[model samples]
Target: MKKTKKLFGALTLTLLLGLIVGCGSSGEDKNSADSSNKGTTDIQKIKDAGVIKVGVKEDVPNFGYMNPDTNKNEGMEPDIARLIAKELTGSEDNVEFVGVTAKTRGPLLDNGELDMVIATFTITDERKETYNFTTPYYKDEVGFLVRKADKLTDTASLDGKTIGVVQSATTKEAIEKQAKELGVSFKYQELGSYPELKTALTSKRIDAFSVDKSILTGYVDDSTEILKDGFSPQEYGIATKKANTELNDKLNKSIEQWEKDGTLEKIYKKWNLD
Candidate 1:
């Protein structure tokens, strides 16, 4: 009877030990997985993925626009993005261009959909809280594009008129502040995309379109002319996820090197921005 009791006790102890060991192994595996995931930075992940994903504009010509014939993104933004990719991965060909507008770029970067954004993204203190931005690679100013027949010679002429601006862009606020300071009042229509704003302007749904002067240059022709006065100066920067300081540092270094080597100036001149 004692032997039977001893055997039962041993079995119970063995089962308890097995359960403890199993739980410990599971915990270790979970910890390992967490550590593995946390060990890689954003740039490291891009390197491992073998391609850098870049968010760029598809409509803003000369900055980031798609070529209809080539069916590829071509512009200063794309050039800069490719240069970064080449610097990081040793090949500009190893880049994937993702189309993003002003409103979508922030959320896409935050969600890890883009490794970086080079889509004429302006650097501001508010945006600094959410993402890391590199040194300004380009500078621009806010201006208006109006039909020549309207005879709108300056920003003040747009008082009491409707203007179209891209949603989530800083142009509207800049214009509003400037207008208020100048004692002028005007209404603005927020469009979801730049093309929509262009359409609104052409259809006379809005008297003018307001945005960065560099962007407006692409849409201007004989019928449209940019206003002589600009409202705000904007600095464009490359943006990455907030936690990706390594990538930002590398990008800043690349920009510094490019500036020193005259590569930046060459690109600016190529785009007629110099």
Candidate 2:
């Protein structure tokens, strides 16, 4: 009887110990996984793959888009991304354009789907936490794009006009804050792409498109398009996930060199933009 009781007690103790050890192992494994991914980024991956995936909007002409006539991706954003790849890997043939919307750009970068994002992304205080941003490559104001036949920006001007914006963009958030403080409400027509936004504005499905004025200058300024200034000085930068400090540092240095050597302005002229 004494031996039976001792054996039972030992068995119970062994099971408890085993479970404790199992839990500890699991916790360690989880932390290991988390730490491994913490500093991992696509910068080196892009170098290894011999191609850089750049998130850009295909609908934002000049800054980023596909020329239907040539069936080729060409724009200032593509130009900058290609230049970055060339500087990093010593080849301009490493560009892979990936379409990204205002919202998807951040998440895609975070997940390593893109090596960098040059999709007319503006720098703001809120965005700094999730991504490393390059020096401001371009600066412009915010504006509204209305149809040629519309009176949205006529005498009264966008004082009471409905503004269209993508749901998760900095532009959307900025305008929301402005509308709230001014005690005004704007009719929201959230669209998926820049092309859709353009089509919506042209068809009067939405009153106007609200975004960085740089895009406006690239798309509307030269065309038979009408734009009205809604806000001022939105700043744009090349972005990488915050884990990619090395790439960001290199890019800033390159941008400075480009500016000093007049290459940056030459790129700007190629796109006919500010």
lDDT of each: 0.91, 0.78
lDDT of 2 by residue, 1-274 (tens): 9999999999999999999999999999999999987666546666668888889878777888888999878888888888888976779877888888887888898898888899888888878987899998787777667766665543135556777776677776777666676676676788887777777776678777877766765446332355554564687899987877888998899888888999889988988886
Which number leads on lDDT?
A: 1
Query: Which 10-residue window of candidate 1 scores lowest in summed lDDT?
Result: 41-50
For residue 150, what is the lDDT in candidate 1?
94
Pairs that collide, model 2: none
Query: lDDT value for candidate 1?
Result: 0.91
Q: How many backbone clashes can be found in candidate 2?
A: 0
Estimate the lDDT of model 2: 0.78
